[model samples]
Target: MELTPPEFTDYDTRLGAYAVIVRDDHVLLALWDEPEVPILMWSLPGGGVELDETPAEGAVREVREETGYDVELTGLLGVETFVMAPEKRFARVGDRPQKNVQVVYEATVTGGELTHEVGGSTSEARWIPLAEVPALERIGLIRKFIG
Candidate 1:
């Protein structure tokens, strides 16, 4: 589907990365605030796949960076495209449209201690009971991944 740019800018495209980590009946999630967005949100621990890195490599790196945990990517979950409006665009260093194409993956937590880092993209990272997840506020895609 065709989507309009979030705003007029030099960069018109954006890409995203995501991971779905499930263990037993629980799933790990990261909660954070997007400065440009009005609400706090919870999602999988992941970020953008860097230019020279493969998605799987990026997934592992991002999970470690955001959650301080190591992960083994098992397989792909799916992909979703989001169109950001001008007001929703959170500019990092340059002016660009705030749209993103997210790649989601299924992964297993291999190792790491649960610890919270200050001034990070994620405020917290913890395991939530799989059943309890539905009741908690989270990205809709997370529920779909669990199903």
Candidate 2:
């Protein structure tokens, strides 16, 4: 799930931070290619919040790792959550349902250049035109960034 956010947590619950970087009518995205995870989709640059990192720090770090951008989080858009049943989750660790809590932030690129992450879950990164979003195959979280 990391290319998509953290190294996945073994706990029954997971918390992730994501960033929405829209610049000059283009939005930065990462192609999530984690093999073990079932879903493969174009997702916002973000990942799981580490134990030591705040949500804002986690979002900034994930953005850099997945999209090659140094983003300064401006404000929070909102938090999204989902509960995956035991059957849907790969394996149960502690609870009957796996709870996913995601914090998405609005950000501005301050530094760094576009680069495809190597040896990570995210295979590629790109800035896609906002007008073309509806036609592309992407994750649901993207809807918050694009029109």
Best candidate according to lDDT: 2
Candidate 1's clash total is: 0
User: What is the TM-score of candidate 2?
Assistant: 0.84
What is the alpha-carbon lDDT of model 1 when measured against the actual structure? 0.77
20-56, model 1: which lDDT tens digit per residue?
9877788888886766656777788887888898877
Q: By summed lDDT, which 10 consecutive residues of candidate 1 come out lowest?
A: 88-97
lDDT of 2 by residue, 104-135 (tens): 99999999999988887799999899898887
TM-score of each: 0.81, 0.84
> Cα lDDT for residue 40, model 1?
78
Q: What TM-score would candidate 1 get against the native? A: 0.81
**Model 1 clash pairs?**
none
